[model samples]
Target: MPSLGADMEDGTLTDWMVAVGDSVSRGDIVAVVETQKGAIEIECFEAGPVTDLIAREGDVVPVGAPLAVIGEADASDPNRTEIQAPPADPTPEPVTSRPQDPPVPSVPEAHEPTPIGTADASMSDAAPQQIRQSAEEPKASPAARMRARDLGIDLTGISGTGPGGVIVIADVEHALEDVTPARPLRHQKDAMRQAIAAAMVRSKQTIPHFYLSHTMDAQPAIDHVTRLNADRPPSERILPGAVFLRATALAARDCPDLNGHDNGEGFVRADAVNVGLAIALRGGGLVAPAVMEAAELSLAETMAAMRDLVARARTSRLRSREMTAGTITLSSLGENGADAMAGVIFAPQVAMVGLGAPHKRPWVVDGTVQPRTVVTMTLSVDHRANDGRKASQFIAAFETHLNRPDAL
Candidate 1:
């Protein structure tokens, strides 16, 4: 179990997509773990054959716990473990008189306390259970078994259609339709809240932050997006959010102070602008997954990426790498939202940029006062890494990008 976030110390293994002896490659999703953020598919970082499975589905264990061990690929090992047929018997033996040894069970070996969920298939006592299961006990995960037990549903007759002919949680959920509609659980929300609180407290204690706010003319960017989307389909239409993100990434070229992290030694600038967008989850929490290499993408590409990121974040389907790789964060209040927003800095990354809803405001243009569309942009930076002068340059560069919306 990998630590999905700073506050997540443990997670529950919900499902295993691969089985013992299965070949796995790098980036293959091996299992799904239920953390405070909900079910996240865990990817394998190595390429090998699965030799041992130490954690079973629905087992809650601390971070860094071994879920499975992938063994080096070797043809000889399979041959060595292969069973051979018994030599021909000289005389016919009576089946009733011959005694048979039970199949050896493969129990999970753990350094920590055993999780109270389903035991691995290898860990099961095969003999007695095999005899009893002749009535066709489906190969179901521990969580599915627990659900069946709780729901008073029989698994013997239901045909399993999961990987390797196993029964999964979805099978149990399908059974749930006959009884009651399954709503999202509440405990996950509470856990997410606690995790957010812990992270915020840590950030506030360690990072010395300073704030800067500027009111930018929003009409130019708004008109640019409006005209660009005028002919495009609804799905491909651009939004003001994309313009803000693009401008931030482009502005970092002139003022790189906002695009880096502090590793206690000193400030280290990132090679690329990976902007993290603060997205709110419907369940009640916030996650800022990155738009990797945001500076390299086009305005339309950024909008598409933002849409996908927000969708995945809300669905609790984000990947491990996406969760940990943000350089700087961007938070925005939508239309009808607050006039301005000042946000806390997510640590390691020294800065956070926020945008408020655009509204008509009085502005003097060429010594004449007139109503203009404007938006407040606020930046939060770490005092240890950069000074106010650099921050001002960044904001100026950002405003210039917004003004030249056609170039964005």
Candidate 2:
């Protein structure tokens, strides 16, 4: 099973997409595994015909365990040789232990396609194991297998859309959408809660955390977005969250300390700004998927990616790249959430920025009372990587971005 997250250990192999004799290529979605984070599509790194399927469906295996063996394709074929073999070995003398003038590469053995678990047919117990293995191997990825299990859909009958006929999570989901035993929301939520607990425990136990809070006026940002959207279609309208994400990313330029991971040895700064957006899932869980290179994207591009990320995250459609792409995190509570939020730092990441719901409040501007849209922004920093002074400056830069929303 592949490690879906830093916290993942053992994952249950839910299905196999390729059968024993099927040919597979590198980058194929091979199997589906169920991790605590969610069902993830496991891609194959080796390309060849499958000789053995070692991992059984619904079996929980540790990370790095072999799921299947990819056999060499016609190893004995002359066309497979890269360098030409010299002619005239016909006059060769008797074999001796002494080394030759120039060493020759050894010829590899030829292999015919074998059934699942029958690659080594000489083993005494091969027949019984082979029968069981052949009955269970269907060539699906771990995530696809888990989804099949959850939805009570049989993998043996479904066709895979992934490379090399490997069934992926999407294929299983489409099957489930048409027919299923029951929705497994409660069970999934419980599993997600456990995963969150383990991660938070690890985060607080090791990382030295400190807090910073600041309140800023939100009128400029709100007005800027409203004016920009006035002439555009409803689909192109920008949300307030996009402004917050872009501003936080821009602040990283001046405060580089807030934008990387601390992997025990030392801090390794990231060259790009992939800001993870903390989204609350509808099934009573949360996931933070990154918006790749947030600082470099225009306001419209950021909003478009944010919309796509949130939609995929909630529906369990996130890819491996998005899940592991975070350099730093940004979280917010929209209109109904708390006035201010104090967030815990995700481990390895040096900082997290949280935004509270923006509300209208009375403010004294030039000796006159005026209603202004204001929001409370909180910055959670890792004390080992940065101090309160730098944290203050980072927040100040963030506020500055919010004040000039046109530049964002």
Candidate 3:
């Protein structure tokens, strides 16, 4: 139960990707926890052999609870305790005919306990036999499960190609090719909406928010994208949204006040501008996963990252870090969105930049009126962390970057 977001206090351990004795490296997906948002792949932060599984599937654990224990490679210690095997059943029957104590399973020397999720260590473990017996609900990646559900395909029939016989998204797609498409299943959008509502309510109640809106001339960015896309293929062409994102990232970099998290005690500025892109899910929910280190990425790179993030978010393939690493957020309405819109400040983040649909408008230019593309940019800021002056400066810097799209 990693803290996927501020609103997440606990999560249900939906699946396990690794078992005891399995070697895991940093960044490996060890388990999947279902938060209110959705199923999130929990990555391993330590490297070594897994010595214990503390949280079993279907166990609801809170954030920072120890979900497993990892051990060092060396196992020469004489006093080392043997690894405790997962329980065969949640409640085992009492045995009256036992003659002696059962032998404990030997394992490598254990290191510090690694906190993965919140659960009582005494809780019943998911035994290996139990894991195998539950073949009707086969092991699959979060993306695979979502895809299978959407396609109305049973995971029990498909063979897994992923490590430890875990079904992946590719396998689901391959299965789909052999059969007709079924009606897509409805997602748990109600739960997601409730989560969003709770977070927004908390944000409003805790943070003093002030909003500022600026309408900028978008003709330069629009023209620049057009010229750049003319020679490129459709797949490689950049959209105006990318330009806006890049501009926001750069502006955030220059204006420190607008680009960091708000700790309860004080403000902590972030070194890298990780811009969280607010993407609406297909069924009717939203997720904002960051394009990590966006300030350092090129315009094309930013566009690619945004596309990838959106695609992964829709399929419930987002990692734990992506869900929690946003320092500043950007919400865009794209070309078909409303002319102007304001967004709520995502808790802990100091600022949120909103981009409205770009459209043609009459503007005075050099003593004469001219029809030009214009976009309304709104900034919602935490007043405790920044005032109106700082917000205006950030907006001004953003406009400067947006106007000079060639430099992005």
Candidate 4:
């Protein structure tokens, strides 16, 4: 058994394609293993006569555990092969079946003559050739081997389609398409998706949410960042997100009610200030990795932490400590230039704030029109925990935090 994911240790053998007395070639699909994520096909790592099958089907094997042995069944008997290997090796050296490196390679066909002599023990006994490990082994193709390597599927468990039992890439594709008694492919991906689904459902259905929107000037803050990063090293530039996180933390401290939730029985106040920053992955899917004790960190520190968190989250390497338990949430759809994005509250979190892209618009300035960086912020608050007035105050305070960010 081989490891599939960072958290996965052992995998259950889903099924076996090859049995004792079955002949297999290198890169052949042999077995299917069920890992946390899905059912993955296995390919043979070596081309040899499988003299013995150690582990049977449905066994949970750890990574690097011995699964079987490959070698000549018997030196004296030319016909001898692993139960998984063919009855006889037409090719004198089994290794010939395997192609050399793609750059320069040799491919040898089965050595048996067009008219292979009858399988007669009388002739073999007369001139006995000492059986070597290579003569009796089954071999698979290189491409098949690579697939199994990444998927962590054992080749002995799979059957092959190529002539002489050679495993091919198509074989792996077809195997993944077929469904079995165990979980189908993408089980782990579906599992993670379900977890996210549950979180969304809990937040939407159970929580009573209220909406609040406001537009604040960003000129001051933009200049503030410019001044801070002016003489600083490129690596030490102040980030806009850090300013937002720091300001949100400060606003939450002032309007504790917005920071807390109404847990039906009463208003529940969270002792810690964990803020979940929503991150959008490249392909799709969104994850909110949290920044703990946001109130305690300075603007620069918060910026550094948020940057690191987003990087790790994109790589799917975020630790458990980086997930959930935020008092308030921030969703940034600014890159998409969405006028506004209404956030779905994650359960227990009183409210979520979404930021829209800032665009220059001409507004009436005294009787004349003037340009300004117009932006929108939407706050989705749980109605169970807060009312319109409370939501309004929270939004007001949030706008103030941005309006006079220096004070914040």
Candidate 5:
């Protein structure tokens, strides 16, 4: 396995998209390797036939171990990326069933004991870690030891998941998660959790964040989505989230400054706006996968992209590209109806708008009071980039757009 990066020492072979005997062209994905972050597609650097696959799916081999042999011994075929697969069990053949002839004579055990220290030293060198552990020394990893210490559980009693019985944190977590109801379901949070944690920490600490909230009537958007989905099939129903994406994109377009990045001296703007929709995963956490050039997509187009994005996000198939490069973001707590929430602005991006829960409240319209559905939007801006007036104007234009949703 070639070293993917500095942080990665090993990778799990998630899947082999191309199998042995399949012709692999340049840029064709041969396998998917799952690092700590997520699964990344491994493409062939050279065009040739796939011959040998030393590592099967789920193998965690060391880096630069030549996981699969490439280039034939003869260098015969121009298309040969690797040599043919060798026969299985190529090691020196060992006797399968021993001969049934008379066995060798057995030696008698000596009753006399050698020097105790010398014999114990020999045993320590000969036997594995299990034989060496005592009341003084623990044969577990730091994680295992820490967990054992914290929980008042002995590592010696728990089975290890690490290599060569080196107790690991997972073995402890598994044992705890199964038996203890107190321990949270940490398994649900994986790579994305770490990514989010790092991002939130960086954003909160490094970036100066400020929030501007606006509560507007939701009837326009509701009517718009209903009308859009009226003639179309059920599968093509336009969700409010789609409208939110379109509105955010349009707002970005109106306020070019918000859609751009700070280049030290002046602002550098992006040509097309991409909006990230923050979606909550099943158990916990959230993923914000962006849809590129959302400003240009029609209602139907935005709906389709929204459907696909949500699908990919839930499946953990969202790539790094899908998660980045958003000029702005629109996070919806739809029906999640949080009255209004302050959302963290993803760094490097200028702004993020959070869509709050839609609820009915009494409102006065030209001296007449009526109940209406209202949804609040909180805009989180990077203070260093744009002032409050620019933010207010963008929200005004966005509200106008939402009011005239039929034109969308």
Candidate 6:
């Protein structure tokens, strides 16, 4: 299983998108793993034909465990050894099997696709039966299965719209709309809360956190946005949050100290600034899915990314990379939120930038007091990876970017 997050030790393999002999390329969504967070679409990082399906559906494999073997076609060996030994039982038994293919070259560890995690004994006991039922049941995506299960909908009667008659989440949703009223999602909020709490606790225990706050003049940014959106439709107008994210991304790019994970060994700066946006789910828990290469995206692109990220996050449709690729994080309380609030640092990530609600405040501009739109920004840094001086410089760069919205 790919380490979806620090708290995710294992996940249940809910569905496999590719079977034996299917060709897959880098970035293809090959599988789906159900975790405390939700069903995350697992992406393939290697390109080739899949040689074997090692971990079957319903198997709760640990992180770094091989799910399948993708190998070069020109390999001479036809009976390649299994990539790794299957999990010891009480691990769920396979419900079905595929014809074995010729032995293929082993995928390098660095290129191996991360799969799902191990579940508890209770889940293991239930897995075989569930897998057996699913094997004979209607074809459906993992998200669709979870949705149908939660809503008590029968899958056999519903027609799938996905590729090759595979049911998707939308199909499940459509079934609900056609029959019963929509119900609240049966998300594991308590479990999610526990996971979040554990990660935070680990961060607090191991990471030495230092904090800094700065109030920025937001009138320039507000004016710039107003002018840009003046002729556009309401749907096309930009939110101030995007501007803040852009500034934060640029500042992170400029200040390397604040832009990467501290891998226990030392501070490793990221090649690109992937800014993780702290989005609160409608149910209860929170997720910070990154807008990959934020520094390279234009203002409009950043806004679009934020909107898409939030929508997918709430629906539990996020990809595995989005869960794990964040180098730094940003938490923002919009226009109606508090004037200022300090945020906890998401560990491994050396810093987090918090943006409070922008409001009018008395300020001295050229020694004259005036009401200016202002925002309180807070920086939480890991003392081990970054000191007070470097943190201060990051905050200063952030302020400078916000002031010059045109350059953001």
TM-score of each: 0.70, 0.67, 0.71, 0.54, 0.61, 0.73
Query: Best candidate per TM-score, number?
Result: 6
Give the per-residue lDDT digits (tens) of candidate 1, residues 1-408: 565554443577888889989988877888887876767777777777787777888886545446777774354563222111111111111111111311111111111122322211111111122222222456664434544554567876665544465554456646655456445575456457755764665466556789899998988899898899899999999989999999988987668877877654567787888888999887478888889889999998999999998988888787665665677889999878988998887766788998999998998887998888899999998888898998999899999999999998
Candidate 1 lDDT at 269 equals: 86
Q: For model 6, how does the per-residue alpha-carbon lDDT over 168-234 read when each residue is reduced to its tens digit? A: 5557767877885544354366457755765676567666788899898999999999999999998
Order by lDDT, highest first? 6, 3, 1, 2, 5, 4
Task: Enumerate residue pairs that collide in model 1.
Answer: 106-122, 106-123
Better of 2 and 5 by TM-score: 2
* lDDT: worst 10-residue window of model 2: 89-98
Q: Over the full model, what C-alpha lDDT does candidate 2 score relative to the true structure?
A: 0.68
Q: What is the lDDT of candidate 6?
A: 0.73
**lDDT by candidate, in order shown:** 0.69, 0.68, 0.71, 0.58, 0.61, 0.73
lDDT of 1 at 200: 69
Candidate 3 lowest-lDDT run of ten: 103-112
As for TM-score, the candidate ahead, 1 or 2, is 1
lDDT of 3 by residue, 193-278 (tens): 75676567646766688899999899999999999999999889998889999999999999997888765455778878889899
Worst ten-residue run, lDDT, model 4?
A: 85-94
The candidate 6 region of ten consecutive residues with least summed lDDT is 89-98
Q: Give the C-alpha miss distance for residue 153 in model 6, angstroms.
A: 33
The order by descending TM-score is 6, 3, 1, 2, 5, 4
User: Which of the two, 3 or 6, has more lDDT?
Assistant: 6
Q: Quick one: how many clashes does candidate 3 have?
A: 3
Per-residue lDDT of model 5, residues 1-408, tens digit only: 433321223456778787666776655656676754456555555565566787888886543333454445344666544321111111111011011211111111011122222211111111132222344443454324434455556665677654555555456556666666652345436434644654565456544788899999878788778777789888978888788778888888989988954432344677878887888888767777679889899977998999988887777676434444566778887785679888997655768898888888897767898887788889998887888999898889789888877766
Displacement of residue 317 (Cα, Å) in model 4 is 3.2
